[model samples]
Target: MNAEIDFAPLLPLEWLAVLAAISAAAVVLSLVLRSPGWALRGLAALALLTALGNPSLTQELRDPLPDVAIVVIDESASNAIDGRDAQTEAAETELAAALDALARDPDAPMEVRTVRVDRRSESVEDADQGTRLLTALEGAAAEIAPDRIAGAILVTDGQAHDPEVFSNFPAPVHVLLTGREGEWDRRLALQTAPAFGIVGEEVDVAFRVEALGDAPEEATRFARVEVRLDGEIHTVVDAPVGRTATLPIPIEHGGSNVVSLSVAMREGELTDRNNAAVFSVNGVRDRLRVLLVSGEPHPGERTWRNLLKADPSVDLVHFTILRPPTKQDGVPVFELSLISFPTRELFMQKIDEFDLIIFDRYRRRGVLPNAYIENVARYVRDGGAILIASGPAFAGVESLYRTPLRSVLPGRPTARIFEQGYRPEVTELGERHPVTAGLVHENAVQAAPSAEDADPGEGPTWGRWFRQIELEATSGQTVMSGASAAPLLILDRVGEGRVASLASDHAWLWSRGFEGGGPQAELLRRLAHWLMKEPELEEEALTAEVAGAEVTVTRRSVETTPGRLTAASPSGETLEAEFVEVGPGRWQATIRAEEPGLWTLTDGVLEGVAAVGPPAPKEFENPVSTGAVLAALADASNGGVMRLADGMPDLRRVRPGRTAAGRGWIGMARQEAYSVRDITLTPLAPGWLMLLLAAGLALGAWRIEGR
Candidate 1:
């Protein structure tokens, strides 16, 4: 409660001033003349002025408003590192207790309002956003006026994502870091990664191994650096600590290639969760070198030439045996236009230069000797690709299978040929294999083989073939079959190379639009790429993709579901992913990611990898708790930042113009805010009473003058 005196004058202040001046002049004149009646006149004038002016005493009942203080606790992903969570909880309890005591104090009162911020509330425009306490603090202070705000305090690791919110804060901001002293940490940093690179070429990756917090710079040296390409460990090197290293990575296939780099955990490290980083670089092919060899000038031979010529990436080297050694013509070689075949140049000279070699109905005619065949067989075993398009000759005596190439060939002809038209079909494995999965003939009028033409009542949309060589798969997967469900296409891997055989040479019949041409081009394209060791076409594999906090895992197989896959998080925790068959051979499942980093998935044999956030997440980039990021805000607001690990400092209330923190104490400003509840007014002196007093005083002074 408070009380004060107030006045209300009947006459204007200027008139009152004039009347007082006249009374002062009269008193001065009377003093000069030595007249006692002058005092009586002065008393009457004072009475008149007093009667015109009204005054009263007012008593007010006021309620003291508690000053508001905002306490922001950061719960971002990085804050969970080490023992920071426990540290934060302890500091919060102490601060709350201190604020409660301050509010209960008799002399001064304050209100503490706490707000917690985490990565969930952070702006997702950038996936790797750090702590966003400043923005949240602004919102928390929106309802309270500047004068009512005592101050604000933040408990975090000091990695703020938004700095603009600090420009116009209503009160001072004090930060309390939540990490212990001498915390050691080593994190991988990807300084530069390209978005695109040509296949078979080396891409440059610039990176660094940082030693942060209490870790010594010398600890960074001799640390094992692991590099993974497409989920497999490609290489390991001893990288220098605190320095940048350039890694030359070879692009494997034409697609997105994920590159993951990680540093080994150091002694007493803060956490290994942030030691790994990942990035993706798309691989594109520069050119496709294809060597197409045709034994004779057949009608379907032009089909192979046209398809290879249409693609700009394919550099086609085509040749047909215009005259075999078996030909007994009357004309001599000198008289006719005949060019010598470069068997030595093609077979042994630069065979490795070609990406693929296609054999279309070629028989031994003493042209390519046994040595040439042996060299070709050696080429396939040495990581080279080969595709055989057989004809009637494969079932006869001059079959290429009878040569040294039989070792790597997937299938052998059964000395029989189906000459009747039959619709081509994809085997169970083909439907799930990357090369044939979701394959469709765009202009095909049929969605499936005619119910009468297809077995099991369903099959792929395709054209009919006039003939196919009956064969049995010797080694490898039979991806496609022909008439009576005979093996038509077989894919195999021998040594380090790949081999595929299409039993029928009449595949060109589909290209000629026989009963509506099928996916001849697409089928041939995929087969050629699969032989070239395209990563996507693997018959059995695992792949993963990240979408925000969820990871989608896909398994491709020729057999049944490969049981349950295990995913190990960055924190070394395992999650079992139950597979659900989404297609013929593709099984998929999604798991929610709790944190951001390199996540690994494996199914006993094959492994897959995915990255949830940025290459180097901003939050993980600086895991060390420091006051630098929020120091400016604290300083500008007259507040200081301190480490919670040191000890919980005293919470004091300071004036707005004074410092808010010191060596052992952090303070909140005293707002001194209040509200008035009631007010009243009453007259002090009445007009009649003042007039009577004035009359008596005048009468007495006049009587004294006469005596």
Candidate 2:
């Protein structure tokens, strides 16, 4: 307990000033009138004033409070280096013990508040600062006022994200580094990478390799780097250290493409975690080439051309066989405005140049010989796509199914052609296939309408078709069905390529608003892209998207149910993801994500990658425990930075105006904080005593003035 004396006014200052003025005037009048009682008059006024003022002695009982010394512990990702974490633990233990001992002393007491900050896989706000200790320090300072703050001590690997946030801190900031003095690490760094690039085009990527700390210059001057994209290793070269090297990397496909560069681990390296770096670059297509072949002019022929032509990314090559040579009577080719068919060029020479080749009601013609037909088959089996829109001609003797191409065809016509109006519906398999699933019948009057009739507004059914050639599924999945529920759309894989068969060419009637005008354009567009092997349209696939702290996982398959999937974090922890069917061939679920980095997903067999959080976050950019990031902050605060690996320094307390650090000891500025618990005011004299003294003085002055 402590004691103090203080004064509080009994009356308002304005009233007290008036009383003083009256007393001074009375004394002056006695002196000017040559009265011998001038001193007596002054004495009476003093007594009266003393009684009115009521001055009292107040005693305050105060309880001393210890000064708070905050110790912010750095547990960020960089502290995971070889011996940094262990070293930090030891230093924390020692610092706590010293502060506790100081608190036990009677002359100088201190309070310790230790704040432990866990590692950050990545932080967006800390992206530019490189470390996150300052935010935590500012928070601690706000909790304890500056008057009682002994000083702030940061125990870290020396890398701070926001050292500039120290302006708000009233106390000095000291750094206690946690790594060895001579440790070395070799790291691969990405100098520059475009966030988006055109698929199949060479993109310029720059990178560097360098030795950190005091490692031998020769050892790092030349390092071997392994470059990979989408998990496939491709580039390996010995790159010179401390310099940027520009190389060409082809963007392989559309959507997210991840590129990772890693350097082989060297002996005695501090840590291999920072030896590699990864980044994501989105892939985009430049253009798509499509070849359209129409056996004869049909209503739907223009529909197909219009869909492809509307897309700016699609380059359409359309041809119409106006008159088959077999149907030609006496017409001369030169006299007519028709040009010779380019079968040899499109089918044999430049076949691979086209992304997709569509055949509408195409049948064997004398113009395209048996060899040319065989070339088309080979093309489909060699990474090319083919779509067959079967008509009554498919049931004829000259059907393309009777040629060598039959082996690649997914179905064969059965000579049973339904010529009645029938609404189209998706098969069970189509509900899970990317191409046919999720397709809405925009114009059809019903959802599950009758094949014979469609009402004004009911089930999902496309506009009625006049004809549907019956076909038997040979190999491949049937996605759509028509009249009597027979296969209307069939998809198959032939070697490395894909093939699709549509049973009718009357789909163009939907575009004419027949019934309601169906989703003919949408269906054909997706079907074409699927045949071209778009990754998102694959029969079996897993994908993930990230938004803030939530990660959405999607799985697509032809199976009846989408089972549980497992997501792996960069830290090697696996979490089960539950998915709900959002559409045919699509299942999605969102999960809480705490760690930021590359996230991998799998259904036991196939695996995919997605990055969560900021791009190339500064926290994980470098994992070495270096003092460079925090050196400036320590200097400006007049604090010393010392490595704990050498030895733990002593903790001391000093006066407020003195320096708070020394060669072997760190000191905290004394705040001299206290709280007043009780106060008592004592009157120096009785009120009656003052009244008697004033009367005696006034009488003496009256008598002296009369004499």
Q: Who wins the lDDT comparison? A: 1
Off by over 4 Å in 2: 1-56, 107-109, 120-130, 168-173, 326-340, 440-459, 548-551, 559-600, 613-615, 626-639, 681-707
Residues 609-682 of candidate 2: C-alpha lDDT, one tens digit per residue: 77665544566555667778777766665566777877888877777656666787777777788888998778
lDDT of 1: 0.82
TM-score of 2: 0.85
Residue by residue across 241-290, what tens digits does model 1's lDDT show?
78898999999877778888888777788776568888888898888888
In model 2, the clashing pairs are 76-119, 131-161, 432-585, 446-459, 446-460, 447-458, 447-459, 447-460, 448-459, 448-460
- Candidate lDDT (C-alpha), each: 0.82, 0.79
